[model samples]
Target: MTSKANRPCVQKLRCLLSVAVGILCAQSLAFRNVDSAAFDSFANLTAKGLDSIAQFGPAGSIALAACLGALFYRIYPNFKRVGKRNQLISVILSFFLALSIVVPRLMKLPNVSFNSFPNYVGGVPKWHKPIFWMVASIQLLTIGFTLAVIICWLMRKAADLVECRNTGEVSTAIPPTNLSIWERGVRFFDGKPMHMTVATLAMVLCWLPMLVIQGPAIIGVDSMVQLVQFRTGHVWDPMTMAELPGYVGQDHHPFFDTYLYGLFDELGLWLGQEVLGFRILIVLQSIVAALAIVVSLIWIKKRTNLPDSCICACWCLAAILPAFPMYMSIVLKDSTWVSIFLLWMVAFFEVIYRCNNNHAIGWRLVLCLVVLGLFSGLTKKLGIYVTTVSLLLAIIVIRKQFAAFLISMLVPAALVIGFVPMVVLPALDIAPGGPQETISVPIQQLSKVAILHQDELSKSDRQAIDRVLDIDHLKPYWQADSADYAKHYGYRLNASSSDRKNFILTWIRLFFRYPKDYIAAVPYLINPFVYGETYYYSGPVRCGWWEAGGSRILTEYPECGLSYTQGKIAIPLTNALNKTPPFSFIGSEALYTVWLPMLALGLTISIRRYRNLCYLIPTVVSWCSLFLLPAHQVRYTLSFLFVFALTIALPFAEVLTKERNISN
Candidate 1:
């Protein structure tokens, strides 16, 4: 004890003895006095710090805290050793993961109010119990920090693997001289060329079973409206005249989609079987979409240094995911938009690849971009913004190819944006949609404020709101999850530009006055995607005699209909597939639109692969666009899944490859 070296060893022994004693005390307290049922409930409500108090009594709480401190003492050093980028990514990913876990539980907890004014404005919640908040905060911070440590370790290992691969230090596992049957099966297609024909055939075959079950097309409400518009030369609603005063066909939905559906309907009518037209259309869309998926995969294989097995796995996923086949059978513009957008993304990425490698740019490629750009921009409203913004970013990065990129993207996009809205819609006598569509989020925010704080509204604020909405009447039509009823059914469509402007200014002013309401509105609407609320992966076939909000279109047009012919097989199989664990995860919209994107971007950034991030541009921009749009419905995020397939699957391909000298 007198010697300095001996004192250090003695101190270490003392610390170990104290930890052992505390752990023993904690165990004794837990077994002696705790009521299992009450303790379990309390544990569910709060973090373990508070749980220790309930489960182990006051004395053991102190011991548990000491034990936790020591545990952190051991963990801190490893966290400090990682690079700054890795540390940052670990923190961000941990926060997201913790929220993903905690949010659903908190949302579903009975008698707990999460959306009170005080909660949104950084004050005590309606629960008003300091102990509850203290416990909740402790749990959240503890879970987050714990996840950060785990993520840091994982990233470090991944980085090491990547470094080893880059330096040719890591080697693939060697199979035994006597390979097993399973290993032999895996090795059979190891080096075979993944041609487009074979790949497309595989994907199309995956879709054919669903088509056979719900043949002639599975129609949605929007599809029915478009079909009716074709037959009558007007949108299904006679209300268009009420809104716009003299419009027959409105460009409210994409007119191009309407025309296409009309032509297909006409084709079926002329062929003497109306259902035949829809069947042909569904089949053609499936085949074309399958081809586009394969094309994108082939392009990715050529451009990136990913393994063939990885590419094959991705093709398998695209072919088998329930959403792809389900949407292929359904008549929605989103399916067509995604297919064109896939081609457009490939063409755009190839241009960037060529520019980066200093290869000569070709005219055929530029023309392809122009043509695809035209179709992509015209496909959906969001496509215009995605293509235009991606092109601008490309120009900024590859300034050497500025004019070519600009003309390739900008010319087609510019012409579509300017001419279509200004020239084409008017020429076709189709009035552009009302401003109500774009103001979904703002109107939703207004609904929350109006419903909760009507007594506090100033007179001028009331007038501004009254121009676009009747606050007193909104409550009956208000839905927390969507602004559809509120924006369209409850809105004053006659409101002019100046009226909208005044309302927008009033909205901004009131946001400062009632910040809590504005803040709470977003999560309320998007809880399905962000807060783990359950949603349908696909809907049942709406064919013969089904109604859209009690519309008579299906009842009236009996000849132009088909039914779900194999419900006995299709229904049970669909339910089982959706409820299955891994399949369920793959089909989830959150995986595509939120979690996967966040995870992929985080990993890439952590590894400092900045250039590789360009592949995520289309997906990230499309996701961001949801904030300003009407809703974050599953169909809206369908493109995210296909767009991200190549980029997100890259790491798996690289890490598992037998080849050692892969580039990062």
Candidate 2:
């Protein structure tokens, strides 16, 4: 019996293969007159092939709309509903109607060809046969639009499922009664007062100086055209007086600046003024970000049952932190990305804890995913890391939605792993052209320079230098340096492949062996509080009270606060009584005294009450990860520091409030 079943299965497979071969033969016969080589070349044409595709653009777009509409209608039962079906059909018809109307309009306009090609080149094979291009383009558009529709339908179905589970029984006419006072206050304020106050104050204090540095040029007081031209292309000129163009491009790694520049370009088209408009957008985003922070506080307060005042205090601490002002002033992507992330976090918490409406949660999550995907794609690649971590955490934390979690995670993961490789990598040309080689010019030159001055170096320093040059160790350092250089330059180094391999290996070994050397180079990684270049401006100024403290007292103060106060002050009588130390140890003791205790307390409280406050873990992990990355720059660390401070301060403030309430 088993043999008979296997024989039939094999026969069926063979029959299917025969049919497939027959179809292929028929297709070949149908196109027999076409030159195979010409057809092959046309099929594999490059970007120029798009022109051929455009000939049937209208029909292709309409076909695409129809196919996508049908696919979506099948996948989503909601679309099958009478009202939904009508809406979807109307949308599809309207899209086609618009395309039909627009095509004629497009034809009437100028051809606007960026390339000059003769209408017909005799004896030259066309890039793509016009009819073939039309059919292929239509198919491509149909598949693309179909996939989009399917995704949207899947999201809608998921959301509806959640809604059914969470709110199916609730009456639409009834309002929820369990609202918190904080929520009420949020509604009362209309969300502007808190944001404007925080952002304006931060900008005035921290960023005003930098803006003044550019002064009249900002407001078009100088020749606007000249200013724009100077800033755009003269990015590298020392004479331009502006800090080297922060924007990353095809040539360099100004990671955060690239996103800002992209945003500037986008807003410029809409606002009609590029530079001034971009500045206004930055200011507005900062304000919105500040407001989001406040709204998040309110959401947290409502959900956690924490006091409004405590949450507000945490928000204040975060906004007023010294680094906060400086970061907000610059049109960098980090601050904006962080602010958006915070807002998402707030929405996530609201759905998870307060709303209890899974449908709403699903929609919010989808919105977050879309925002995250676009932002990550446009900004730094680190957005991928952020999204991955968030997704994994969601899976673990919301185990009931494990299936949904897996599906949702796949969207971003596919984007990063698939689209990145297929699209972004090719566009950027990041793939190695050949076997890698070690390019050790940078390391070799540095080592040679050091060797020349060996006699001038101390014995210990000399030995350390010698260790760095050992081929086994040096290979890793060289390799890593080459890779870094490539990343920095936005292109692979042109060198022997072996040199690239050796350079990478040498850099890796050096990095692990003397991690501090590389890590210390990061601006914010070391001591986040200290602003290196602008340390003087950032430090506290001396006042009358500090002058009253006298010399010995001032000497013991940390460099940051030295101008304000030095050492412990004691009256002569008090000093004479007992020789016991009057103050805490200055350096190490002072450094750890505040931050360590708070960190320890915060960690202890958070972990012990993880179930109750697990949301805080992401905030903690984000900051700690920032610390561990190569650059420990203060600005980078400051972003997480504020997160940490807010986490701890909010709870501590609540405890104080509770105690006061009991006393009252």
Candidate 3:
């Protein structure tokens, strides 16, 4: 019987190996076909008589694959056991190895043409080349080999360390505590109907709007049709670039747009249905995002042994908490990015807290960084910023996993430098010799005109205009249009040659100088969150502060203050309580209100007893940061509210638990 069992296991292993080899071969063939096709079309695709892949070489492919592989590896059980130091060394070596391969290939293909493919294909062609195939393959192989070596080394080292710590000792393990609160909580709620009910209710409440909007789009609704038409034609205005009338425009930085529309286009092409296809894609993504949230929440509940009700509340709050619904309904990048971000956060927390030891943490960290980095790179500029910040925070908190964090950060850095600047900027024709020149002319002329007009205005009007135009105090435009002021005005405002650099430095200073103005505009970042129909309109509608016809609302209805005012009140209240002696009662009462009460409660509870709840700090700070930073628009604070809701609820959950214990 034992021999029969052993034979079956051996057969199964052989079969698995056969499948793996088949997959590898198939992938190689597919890559070759794609690469040949790309090379054939290169002449039609190049604008500067240069090869796209040849110029950039295989670096991106290798970098992208390595990053992606690291991310995927985190989900694997085996890699989760590698030590942090070993993992870091492996990643660094692998990265350099990828670069070594790519640099030589790029040198070899320096003069190749890139545009022929598009010309031959007669439409947007997928450009897959052999260089990329080779690079990606090498990346995969290197990372896999490096990781295996690191794991083996770490395992051996761990064994030796264990022996050294407990030499000649034979000890039995102690049993786990039976009376632990978490254990009891799990036992009490196991297979209970109430747990399921709470979870179901929370999910429904949080995700119902997403379902309503997404379902219609998925099923070929009229609303989606209108939205696509408006977005393609009005929003983008691609006709001018094509030198044709009404061709529907494309955003050169079309990662978000393409992602949103490509799904529809693909579905339509496949099914012979164009109008309903894009909408269905959007709806499907929303559904998937909602489901992912539920799944993550379930995982959290299982892992943390937190009350089912608490988990349910967090899920519901995350889902319906306003920010998600507004963004997820639109064909924007935020929904997808936010969904991925939340997933990453969950994965990150799990890897840090639940991993077996330093080795597991290291591997998991590497994986998390890769996923987060890729999403950030492929999504939006903000995605990169968020990813960097999150990775930094992870490294700081999980000091043992710093190597993984650094390796992960390289993914985003590569995207920003290689993809965004080289690929995206060139495609958009926003390069020095591109359409940016035209845009810069108007911007520079406008700035000069505004300044010239400033001299002719009345003293009071001049003061107000000066306050708005404070160019000396304001950060200069950075990005592609740094010479904008000088180009139009015939004089340089700053010594910097790079326009983007000047703008960033100036913007940074301006933001620091008037932090309150920046914070007030947070709510206005989301369109629906603003209490008006107009794009620029924000805040409460009672005063029409942001309304087109309510220009005098600020003066006439001063009592209906800006949202920033409320945030300002919150800062003092929170700050005073934290100090040795609290601030005067008069100022506190002035800012006190029922809605603002939660802010105080949240701060108080966080400071007093929940200081260890570090997760809450980011949300709180993000909320406060948006409120206190530049441009306090209603939509800007939408994400803040979603986070704020969870922060407030945690304290209440604790209170409920305490009450229950006391009563029992």
What is the C-alpha local distance difference test score of each model?
0.63, 0.38, 0.39
Better by lDDT, candidate 3 or 1 = 1
* lDDT per residue as tens, model 1, 1-664: 1598797775677566446544443332222111112224455433543554554356646656476446544554457668787888889887886565444433422322322111111122223445444534554566567657666765665566557657777335656766545343334233244545666777899978777765546676666666765675444342222434355566667778878877887888899876677778888888888888777776655455444455667777877766677778777788778888888887877776666556656888888888888887776777878888888877776676776777887787777778898988888877776678777778888877988887889889888888988766778777655677677566786789999999899888898898877866665445434423222234444432233232433333343443545456555556665544345556655666666767667766666656566666667677567777655466777776776565564343232234333221
Residue-by-residue lDDT tens digits, candidate 2, 396-509: 775555554555456767776567557764564333112211222334433433334446545554444443344233333332212332223222333444544454455454
Please provide, for model 3 over 68-110, each residue's C-alpha lDDT reduced to its tens digit, 9 standing for 90 to 100.
3443333333334554544554454444433322222222122
lDDT of 2: 0.38
**Model 3 Cα shift for residue 494 (angstroms):** 14
The most accurate candidate by lDDT is 1
- RMSD per model, one decimal: 8.7, 29.9, 27.8
Ranking by lDDT: 1, 3, 2
Candidate 2 regions off by >4 Å? Answer: 1-275, 315-325, 347-361, 393-398, 416-421, 424-525, 529-607, 627-630, 641-646, 649-664
Name the regions of candidate 3 deviating beyond 4 angstroms.
1-256, 269-272, 303-305, 315-327, 351-360, 394-398, 423-613, 616-664
